[model samples]
Target: MNRLAYQYVVLRCVPRVDREEFLNVGVVVYCQAADYLQVAWQVADDRLRALHPALDVDQVRDALGFIEGVCAGDGRGGAAAGHPVGQRFGFLKAPKSTVIQPGPVHGGVTTDPAAQLQHLLGCLVG
Candidate 1:
């Protein structure tokens, strides 16, 4: 199978930004050449509570849900729904100061981005 260039970012939940602590909640992969974009997420609630017992995991899940919507073109709340795959990925990967944030941008080559997304989520967030 021919490989295509891809870029990805680790989705993080920073309960507290000042202390710089975060938990990996998901992975977003974008393969421009393949016109593919998707996200795989596993919310470690126990780990989230470990960071801060008062942390609101539902809020995190809600935020992540929007990302899932963006990837699927579900048009949830009309956020980045009609944009190109690359633009949608750009919107998802943009940095934010809120509870859910994206880590540094990273790149690789993959023949199967969807499979690679699951693999990365398992490795990074599990």
Candidate 2:
């Protein structure tokens, strides 16, 4: 299989932006040639609580769910709905000042974007 270029961003949870602290919570991977865009996430509740006991884990999960919705082009994507894979990815990776945000964009080559997503999620977020 021919390798294809892919772009990705690590999803981060900034419990306190003022302190410039964040927790890696997920990953978004986009492989245009493969028509693939997806996310793999795992919220470490204990770790997040250690960071900010007042932080709402449910809310964080909800934000992550919205990302999943955007990837699927479903109702959860809200204004991002109806967009193609690349556009959806752009929306997800856009800079934001919120509890859930994306890290810097990165690139790599992959034969399976799905597997790559998992690996990155583990390496970067897990």
Candidate 3:
């Protein structure tokens, strides 16, 4: 069976309207497969603030290989050919388009933790 590895960075920033609250900032590296998955994420805080931008892009790409190794359980086997990390990770998804934006939608398949985790893992192992 052929398995694939995917990775992407999620950059979150709190708009000034929120008074610059520390939101989920930085990138997340995730590897998924049919049966196993692993994710490593680093946040940008005071000590690691400066590294945020560069790390966001570079780490995310580097993470594809790292995550593949972790999922392979041997730290080997490079990324598969033609993997769409951004789309798979929702990076390319357009933001919710609505003239009158409603509050955060609570009821949704994406909000399910177990399902989300399972999907993530499946992406790494499959």
Candidate 4:
């Protein structure tokens, strides 16, 4: 199989942006040729709580769910579904000031985006 170019971003949880502290919470990946755009996330509740004792897991969970919806183009995706794949990816990769933010965009080549996504999740967020 030909190697396909892919891009990914590590999703971070910044409970306090002023302190510039964060925890890796998830990964979003996109491969246009494979038409695969998805997110793999694992919220380490204990780790998160350690970072910010006052952090609410429920709110963080809701934010992760919204990202999943956007990746899947579900109704909860809001206006993301109306855009093309690249646009959707651009939207997700853009920086944000909220609790959830995307890290810098990174690139690689892969034969299987699904497997690559898992690898990234493990290496970057897990």
> Would you list the C-alpha lDDT of every candidate in the order shown?
0.90, 0.92, 0.34, 0.91
Encode model 2's per-residue lDDT on 20-97: one tens digit a residue.
889999999999999998988999999999999999999999999999999988898798868988989999999999
Candidate 4, residues 86-124, lDDT tens digits: the string is 888999999899999999999999999999999999988
Residue 83, model 2: lDDT of 90
Candidate 2 clashing pairs?
none
Any runs in candidate 2 off by more than 4 Å, and if so which? none
User: How far out, in Å, is residue 40 in model 2?
Assistant: 0.7
Candidate 3 Cα lDDT to native:
0.34
Better of 1 and 4 by TM-score: 4
lDDT of 3 by residue, 11-105 (tens): 23332223333333333333344322333334333423343333344443353444444333443424321244433333222242211111221
The TM-score leader among the candidates is: 2
10 residues in a row with least lDDT, candidate 2? 72-81
TM-score of each: 0.95, 0.97, 0.23, 0.96
What lDDT, from 0 to 1, does candidate 2 have? 0.92
Candidate 3: deviation at residue 105, Å? Answer: 26
Sorting all predicted structures by TM-score, with the top scorer first, yields 2, 4, 1, 3
Off by over 4 Å in 4: none
Look at candidate 4 and tell me the lDDT of residue 71.
Answer: 89
Ranked candidates, highest lDDT first:
2, 4, 1, 3
